[model samples]
Target: MDIGKQIKTLRLGKALTQTGMAEILGVSKSTMSNYERNISTPDPDTLRKIASYFDVTVDYLFNDMTDSPRDIIKEGTAYHPDKALNKDEWNAISYYRRLSDEQKDFIKGQMIQLYQKSSSSNKG
Candidate 1:
C-alpha cells in the first residue's frame, strides 16, 4: 500500500483521530489530513517520529507490504530494521550525498583514518 493509505490504516487500527495524531505529532490537524491523503510527504524528522510511534521501521513506512494493512501491526514489530539514525547522522549522510566525487573520497579517507585512530586508542 502507499504511505498515505498505510498511515490511515494504522491510525484507524489504533482508533486515533487525525486531530489526536496531529496533537501528538505537533502538527496541525490539516497537516495530518494532508499526510493521510497523500497531499504531502512528511519531512525526515516527522517520518522518524511516525515510525517510532508505531514501532515500525522507516523502511516499513516506505515499502509496500501485505495486501492487508492490518497485517502491518501483526508483522511490523517482527521486522525490525536497524535502529533509527539520529538527526546529526542523517544530516551527515545528506551532506555526504551532495559532495563531488573528489570531496567524497577525501571525506571517506578522513573518516577511515578517524575510525582507525579511535579503534587503536580504544585497544590501548
Candidate 2:
C-alpha cells in the first residue's frame, strides 16, 4: 500500500472520519481528503505527526513494506516473506503493541482462559 492508503487504512480502522483526522492533525479536511485520495502528499512535519498519531514509524508510511510493518520482529526474528499479513491482522498487532505491559498480560491471560474453556467444552 502507498502512504495514502496506509493513512486511510489506519484512520478507518480507528473509525475516524476524514474531518476528525484533519482536526487531530491540524490540517484542513480537504488536505486530509487529498492525502487519502493520493492527490497530494503531506509535508514532512505533517508526515511525522501522522506517523506519531498512528503509533507507527515514519518508515512504515514511506516504505513499500506496508504488507508488513517491519521486516523483523523485536526479538530479531525475520518474518517469512510468503506469509504476508492482511490489514485487519496488522491492525490488531498495531493495537496490541500500544498496550501497556499489564494490559497485555491481562489480555493474554483472558485469551488463554477462553481458549481452555472452549477446548474443554469441545472434548465432551
The C-alpha TM-scores of every prediction are: 0.53, 0.70
lDDT string, candidate 1, 1-124, tens digits:
4788777766775689999999878999999999988899889999999988776678878766435232221245685343445546644764686689999999999999999999999999
Q: Scored by CA lDDT, what does every candidate get?
A: 0.76, 0.83
Error of 2 at 67 (Å): 7.5
The reply for model 1, stretches above 4 Å from the true place, is 69-124
Residue 96, model 1: Cα distance from true site in angstroms: 38
Clashes of 1: 0
TM-score of 1: 0.53
Give the alpha carbon lDDT tens digit for every residue of 1-124 in model 2.
4778889977987899999999999999999999988899999999999999988788778676645544443445655656566667776778898999999999899999999999999998
Pick the lDDT winner: 2
**Residue 63: error of model 1 in Å?**
1.7
Which pairs in model 1 have colliding backbones? none
**Model 2, position 109: C-alpha lDDT score:** 99
Candidate 2: C-alpha lDDT: 0.83
User: What TM-score number comes out for model 2?
Assistant: 0.70
Per-model C-alpha RMSD? 11.9, 3.5
